[model samples]
Target: MTVADLVVDCLEAEGVEYVFGLPGEELEDLLFALEDSSVTFVPTRHEQGAAFMANVHGRLTGEAGVCLATLGPGATNLITGVADAQLDKAPLVAITGQGGRERLHKESHQRLDVVHAFEPLVKWNAQLSDPAATTETVRKAFKVAEHEKPGATHVEVPEDVAGEAVDGEPLADHGPVARPAPDDEALASAVETLEGAERPLVLAGNGAVRTNAASALRSFVDATGMPVVATYMGKGAISDRDERSLMTLDSGPESAAGGAVERADCVLAIGYDIAEHDPSGWNPGGEKTVVHVDAEPAEVYADYTPEVELLADPTAALDRLADSIDSQWDAWCVDAHETVYEHATRTPDPGDTVSVSNTLPILREAMADSDVLVSDVGSHKLAIAREFPTYEPGRCVISNGLASMGIAVPGGLAADLALEDDVVVATGDGGFLMNAAELETATRLGCSFTVVVYRDGEYGVVAEHQEQHRGESVGVRFDNPDLVAFAESFGVDATRAESLDEFGDAVDATESDELSLIEVVLSDPPDRRA
Candidate 1:
């Protein structure tokens, strides 16, 4: 067997179903091996799109989504998406093809230090110089990528090494590393803090969903009656319909959910990664006592020093804490959530164009509770993060870590493939155009999902920031072609919706077996700062 064959075998053993990437000369051998295996190779329009596909696939399935690229630019294109996975705590395995070892030692065409370049973007990375070590290397990549606090991992195979003869089988699957429970003293301290605080709150993050701690979290909330405020990526950790759920916390300190954070004397942050939403934004005063619970210890920050650190599996910690806690506080933050809901569902003024606020409720009504909504980074992302109501864990996926634009199109495709659920991609015009070519990729693969583009002809987020600071927006505005036509050109069904009713009808008309795009022209950029 060739080393390339062994790599594919390892991937199959890891239960990897799809490998998203573009064809490259250096990847010839690996591509050939994938073709012969049961693993499906999805050729994307760009390496960036491929990585984003893997990013979302990992985030949704809790498995290491795989993506492949060639040397130099092909590997570099995967940076943003891989870094996004790293920061978002999504499990992903990135494979890159390298030039021959002889050529890599010196300056050569399309040759770069891919392993070195990927160091900061992944939890673990290595180049395969020894053909005999293929099984161990491939197995380690999956293990590290899917470990607790999951992120990206990289494996670079030289073109020569990939085709070299090898004799070995794939490594045995040992399953995930088992996490330990919280210690006695730490659990006792956390319970005491919760009991003493008059207005304690729960701040859930992506880790809560990733660790499958939602059920335990809900039970803890039930026992304590604590209001849970989720970070953007933390949405669906607790059902939005629950009275105890205060919805998502926005970036600014003045947000509706921020009021709860400001009022709480104790904050029980469950699986809350400081990367998601910095503690400085929510706890600017640094007066609240924090009870940190996660698989990893708390990141040291002036504003987020945890008084009680439960460094254990969030699920186990939460279950123990729920059992130990004695008092149940009233759900004091429900009123704040009411304001958030009202603001999110508010109708737009009578106009020719539709607004995100008006379109969200319609889209939510059209989608089932199990459906997934992938959001690209832009002004629309801010609105969706705060306003969109998600009922199930991993259902509302947003790129809040690297917060990279252009993730929605490819991310929606991955969500559809991984979850087999109705998917809707929410993106602004700027983000939509970044990976628009992937619409063709989606169409070719017979993907069934809807891309909703909020057309404002500008980078809405940057423009909003500029407007807020300088009183005028500059350099962020641009022109765009008819988005409906752009999407239709990709062999996808397209429509333009000018009002909420029309948008709802367009969403309803979308066929479940084909790709669809809805372009909503906005009269003004969404005021996400609110």
Candidate 2:
């Protein structure tokens, strides 16, 4: 059997069902071997897109999301996505092609220090030195990627190794992961704090979202009678339409998600990863304490040490906590939430076209059931992250902790592939430009997702900040370019969001087969986020 065959065999044994990636000459043999296995290779336009799609697949499937990139450019292109998964603690296995050992330090076009480049962003990085070690490499990479504080893992396959023949017998199937359950002592202590607290709040994050812990989260929230405030990645964890939940306010010196962390007497951060939230967001107020239950123990004090930290299955922890705690806080929180919502709904500085105040309501209306929303990073993304309500699971996706732009288009494409339903991507112009080339990706794959460009013609966040504190804009303004033509290049449809009526029609038409772009010019004066 060839070394590439062993690699595929190891992956299949590990039960990896899918890999999202772009191919390069160096990894072609491995790809060919995968053709016979149940493992499916999904093609993506850019390595970054493949990485993001893999990240999402991991989050959704509770397994490692695998992505492959070739040497040099292929590996480098996936850095943004690898960094994102690391920050949010998602399990990602990124396989890349590397130059042969004989060619190391020699002239190679698609070669760089792949290991060093990815070291900062990944939990583990290795370029297979021993072909015999491929099986073990795959095994360890999977474990570490899914280990406490999960992140990306990289294994660089040298070109020569790919073409070599394997001497060892085919590797055995991988065994199951061994995760430590919550210690009885910690569970007892966590229960004690929960049962006695006057008012409790459940703060959820990407980890919670990935663990299928929403029901557990709901049970805990119901038991405590408290409100749920999600981080960006945790948006749909509690089905925002439910009054028991509160929106993740992204503005004000502190947000509602942050306030929820502070206002409660006890904070039960179920599967919450502090990295997904601003540092200030996790600081509880005087006398208030956090009981952090997560899959990773080391993450316990990485930001702020919780009074009780339990490394256990998120859903399992929640069930145990719910059984031990009971309160009437939810009813009271409902009232508090209504007031918060009213104050929050107020309009912000008018933009070139519509006021930021009007943006949320209109968007909320536009993206209803059957519409998938993709939010970019920065002010516009922050607004959507704060205001838009996600009623269903997986209906909305965002680069919460990473806060990268250009993620929406690729992410939207993946969502389109996975979910054939209507998809809408909300992006700041700068951010959209990151993966705008994916318009061809979406078109070629016949992936239909509507793209909405919240065009401020300026870096709205930095501009507003400069205007507020510095009285001048620097490194923020851009000579507005025609976005329609950009989409047209992909042979997709395009239009501008003029009056409210025209904008409504455009959004109504977003679901059509032709990928559509609705450019909403932020011509109005910029304002600070609430």
Candidate 3:
């Protein structure tokens, strides 16, 4: 059998159901092998979109999502999404096809050092130099990508090597092993600090949601009666509607949730990662006692030092901490809960402008509680993290680590396929156009999702920032095409909603199993401080 066949076998053994990429001549052999395998290959409009699809698939599944590309430009185009996955702690395996081995000593067409190019962005990467090592190499890539603090990995297969016959079997799938337990001394120290504190808080990060420990996290927070705040990517770690939740801490000390952080004497940082919310902004003084709980050790940062680093499974660590607490902070919890509730529940003044504060709750009501929502990087993403309530972890997908602008469309496509849930994407006009071509990819694949384009006819986030800092806007405005016609060109059902009533009507009319787009013409720009 060909090396490509064995590679496909390894992916099947890992339980991968799909591969996403655009085709190139270098990948011809692998493509043919995929056709015979059970894993479905999704051909995307662009390599960037394919990488994004793989990224969201990984984020939702906690397994390595696979994306393929040819050498040179194909490999380079996959960098952004792969880097996004890396920084966001999503498990992604990126495979690139290289030139023939014969050209190794000399410059050849479409040949570049792909392994080196990917090294800085991946957890681990290697060139598949020998056909004999195919299965083990593929196995190692998946294992590393799916390990604790999951991130992207890469495998480069040269054209000649892929075509060569190789006799090998996929490594045995032993299933995942149990995570290490927290040290007794560390756990005891954390509980002592937490118990001694007058006001304690929980800072949830992407790691909390990624590990599927939200329920355990909630139990800890509820049992201790502590306020909880999540980073932008960490939204939905506990349901936003939960009394202990303090909305999202996206703007650091300036956010409504930030008030809790300021008042917190001791912080239980559960599944926290510095990439999502750097400690320098909120913890400028570095004085608050912190208990770090996660699947991996804490990343070293000058301003962020944990008093006790509980390196263990987040769920188990939280479970232990909950049982060890001798007292509950009921008064602190009530005050903290009210502070966020006031910010979250405030109504916009009666006006023509459709506020995100109002729109997102309505949108949430229209979709199933289990349905997924993907947010593109823009002013809306900041608002969505605060306003949109996510009932479960992984239900709200945001690229906070890299905060890439065009992830929503392709990410929603992957979310639909990965979670088998109705997906809704929110994007500004500029962000929407960045990968809007992927609408055709979703249509071709029979994947259905709704796109809500916040049409302001400019780079809304940049413009808002410009206006805030300079007291005026420039160099960011652009005219948008007729969005309805643009979406309809891909055979998607499209409409325009001029008001909140009209927006709700349009959303309600859209079917879950059909491709649809609703262009919501914004009456005003988003708040910069929010």
Candidate 4:
């Protein structure tokens, strides 16, 4: 068997269903091998889109989503999405084609050091230099990528090496790496702290969702009666529908969820990553006693020193805590929840111009609880983080880490491929156009998902920040082509929604088997500042 064939075999053994990327001459052998294997190769319009597709696929399915790219420009283009996966803690295995080892001693055309370039963006990375070690190398890549604190891993295959003859089988199937249980002392200390605190709260982050601790988290909340505040990436760890859920924590101290955090004497931070929302934002004084529980140890920060660290599987830690902890509730928790509820339920003022506040609710109403919403980074992202009510884990995908703007379109495509439920992408006009070429990719792949573009004719987030800090916005405004016509150019169904009613009708009218786009014109940014 060829080295390319062996790589494909390893992927199939790892249960990889799809590989996303733009084909190149360097990847010719690998692509042909994938065509013959059970794993389908998805050709994207851009390498970044391919990486994003793999990123979301990994986030949703806990498996290491695979992506391929040629060396030089192709590898460089994959950097942002791969870095997004790393920072967001999504499992992804990235393969890049490299020039032959013969030309490594001297400078050559399109021969950048891809392995070195990817070092900062991956948990582990290596070149496939020895064909004899192909099986072990591939297995190690998948293992490291899928391990606790999952992130991206890289395997670079030289063009000449990919065509080399190999005669080995993939490593024996070893299921998922088992996570360690919480220590007795740590567990006891956590229980003691929670039982003693008058105001204890749970702060769920992306790790909670990544570790599948949502069910255990709910049970713990049910037993403890403590309010839960989720980070943007942690939405639906405890359903927003739950009375104990204080919704997502916004940027400032005045946010309703932030208020809950401020009032919390003890915070049971389950699978919480400091990167999601910096501890200083919520625990400004570093006074709140933190009980950190996750598969990995807590990151060291001045504002986030854990009183007790339960370095174990989040699911197991939560399950144990649920059984040991006593009910702990405070009136302030209820007040915070009520405040969030009021804000979410508040009706928008009737007007001709559509706003994010009104637009989101209509889309939420039209979507099922199980349906997925991939939010692109922009002003709309902040609105979604604050106002959107997610009901299930992995149902609301946000790129808080790295927080790249172009993720939504390709991310929606990946979500649709990985999930049976409906997928929706919420992007601002700026983010929409970043990867808009992928609309054609989705169309060609027969992906049935909806893309909702919030048209404000500017980089709304940057403008809002500029306005907030400088009292005026500049360098953010731009004109756009007719978005409806732009989307329709890709042969996708498109419509323009001038009002909330029209947007709701458009959302309701989305077909199950067709890719569609809805352009919602917004005259003003939603008031999300706390």
Candidate 5:
């Protein structure tokens, strides 16, 4: 068998169902092999879109989502999404094709040092030079990408090498390696710290959701009677409807949840990664005692020094903590609870046209319990993170760490494929146009989803920031095309909603058989800063 055949065999052994990419000359051999394999190669309009799709797929499945690209420019285009997965902690395997090793030593056409280019972005990376190393390289890439603190990994195979015959065999599949339990001394110290505090709060981050610690997190809160708050990406780690949930922690210095942080003497940060939530904004004083629980040690930061760290699987650690702790705190943060309610019930101000405050709740209610909502990076992202109620951990997908725009459309498509759930893309006008061509991809795949475009005729987040910081907005506005017609060109039904009632009707009337777009004509000023 050829080396490319061996590579495909390894991917099959890893149980990879989809490979997203755009075709190129260097990838001919690999593409030919993929045609004969069971894994489907999803062709996208651009490598960026393909990378985004693969990135979100990994985020949802906890497996290494694979994306393929040719050498040089194609490889470079995959960098942003790959780096995003690296920083955001998503498991992804990025495969790129290179020129022959002999030509790579000289000034060869379409050849560059892909390994070093990817070194800064991946947890591990390798460029295959020998045909015999195919199976081992592929196996190592998948293993490292799916390891604890999961992130991106890269494997590059040259054109000549891919076409060469090889006798490499696929690695034997084995059951998952068992995770170690938390140390007894550390667990005891964490419990002691919690027991000593009168007002303790639980801070959930993206790691909590990635580790599937929702049930354990809920039990921990119930047993201790402590309130829980989530970071932007951490939303839905506990049901927002739960009384113990303080919705989500607002970003910036003065936040609605700041009162809870101020009143609490101790913080139990479970599966909390610093990337999703910046500690400086919330913990300016750096005085609160912290108990860090996750699959790995806490990231050392001046504002986030842990008094005790429980390094182990979050689910296992929480289960052990629940079994060891027997405590009750009757005193709750009444003010924080009130703040959460106020935010949850907030409505648009009188005479304000097209407001998220009035629109998101209707959309949330209309979606099924199993449906997924993906948020693009924009002002709406901040609002959704705070106002959207998630019943389950994977239900709400938001890009909080890298905060990349244009993720919603492709991300929703990926979520639909991975979860087999009806998906919704909530994006702003600026973000919509960033990768609007992906609409064709969605249509080609026949994946049904709803795209809600908040039409504000400007970069709303940047405009809001400029207005707040400089007392005036400039150079951030732009004219948009007739979004409805634009969407219609792609053979998708599109409509414009000018009022709350109209938007609600649009949401209610949406079907899952075809792609739909709802353009909300929003011209109102930004809501008060969080």
Candidate 6:
């Protein structure tokens, strides 16, 4: 058997049915093996798109997202996405081809130490050398990525190694892990905290969204009349319309969440990994006791010290917490819910041009009630995060922890595939240009995303820092092309908006198989993230 055959067998064993990548000469052997394999390889326009789609695939399906690229530049291009998955703790497997083993130390043009470049960020990085170790190496990479505290793993395969002949059969299938159930003491301690507290709020994050905990959390929140506040990554786990649940806002200004949590007596943090969202603005420490629980122990008590850490499955923990505590809300949670309701409708100042405060509410009105949204990273991303109030599942996508650039358009493509309709992607002008060329790919696939370009005219997030922290702009600013012209070049529809009514009309005109690009002109003091 060939090493390439074993590689395909390993992927099949892991239940990975999707592979995203751009083919190159170095991957010829593996691509040949994958030609008619069980998994369907998605040929993306760029390695950045492949990485982004891989992340989306893994996120929505709860499987490790897989992608491949050639050695050197091909592998280098996926760094933005790879680093994103690493920071967000996403389980993604990225493979890159390399020059032959004999040329390892020589400067064979495209040769570089790719493994070392990714080592600092990844949970583990390895270069597959021996044909004998192929199966075991593949198996271990998948397991480490899927196990507790999941993150990205990089595996490099030299051309010689992949093309070599191997005598043995492919490795056996790996099975589900036997995760330890919640211990009696831990469950008891969690219940005691919930039972004794007069006003408790359940804060759910990515962990709850990724598991069966959403329904379980809703059940507990409803039974106990506790208010629910989900993180950006945990959006939609709790229904937005539910009275006991706070609307989902994973990333944004921390003021509201910080204020709310400060007033609560007990905070039950389920799957609340601080990694997915920054804790810079929100302070969890206070007189209130926090009960932190997740499948990953390291993510526990990250933002604030947990009064109790229940190392158990999120769904099981919430289910047990529900059964352990009795229903009681003495108007405190109700008052806190009322406070959030008041802020949900608040908008940016009338004179505020650059603030996201005003832009968000305006965009929300333009959004189709069911339209899917994706965000690209920047200060603008943070602004949109706070501004848009998403109350449902599968409506939004972003690199919560990874914060990868060039993801907006690609993620929008994936969202279109998932929902089979036009999607709306909000990004800064700089990020849009990063992979705006992929608009052609989206057009070819007959999928579209309403490209809401926040034209701050530069990397405004970095620019914002330079102006605020350094008192001037340094490495930001660009004269971008006309959006209408760019989209027309791809045979896709486009429009530019400078006014409120124009923005709404632009969005209303978007339809299936028709790509729309709506570029919002920036203000000198754009408070886009208000």
Worst 10 residues of 6 by lDDT: 248-257
Instruction: Note the Cα lDDT for every prediction shown.
Output: 0.88, 0.74, 0.86, 0.88, 0.86, 0.74
lDDT per residue, candidate 2, 491-515, as tens digits? Answer: 8889987555556667777655667
- TM-score for candidate 2, residues paired by index: 0.88
**In candidate 1, what are the lDDT values of residues 147-261, reduced to their tens digit?**
9989999999999999999999999988889998889998998999889999999999989998899999988888889999999988999998888887887622258788777
- Candidate 5, residues 304-349, lDDT tens digits: the string is 9999989888888888888887888643865666667556655544
Summarize candidate 4's per-residue lDDT along 404-494 as a digit string, tens digits. Answer: 9899999999999999999999999999899999998898889999999999888877877877897777778777899999988899999
What is the alpha-carbon lDDT of model 4 when measured against the actual structure? Answer: 0.88
Error of 2 at 282 (Å): 5.2
Model 6 agreement with the true structure over 1-530: per-residue lDDT tens digits: 78877888889888877678889898999998888699777778899888887776666555788989999999998887877877766678999999999999877879989999879867888999988888888888888777766778999999988999986555665565655678889899888888888768787777787664778887787767787777777766776556665554332245455556556788788887777754443443334577878886644344577788898887777778777777676345454445554555555454556444556776666566566778888877776555466665546666778676788888787667656544788888888888887787777777756788877667777777877875677767677788778778988777887765566566677765567887777666533332
lDDT of 3 by residue, 81-170 (tens): 999999999999999999998996688897899999999999999999999999889989999998888999999999999999989889
Candidate number with the higher TM-score (5 or 6): 5
TM-score of 4: 0.97
* Ten-residue region with minimum lDDT total, candidate 5: 250-259
Name model 4 segments beyond 4 Å from true. Answer: 251-254, 330-332, 347-349, 524-530
In the predicted model 5, the residue pairs found to clash are none
For residue 417, model 6's alpha carbon misses the true position, in angstroms, by: 3.2
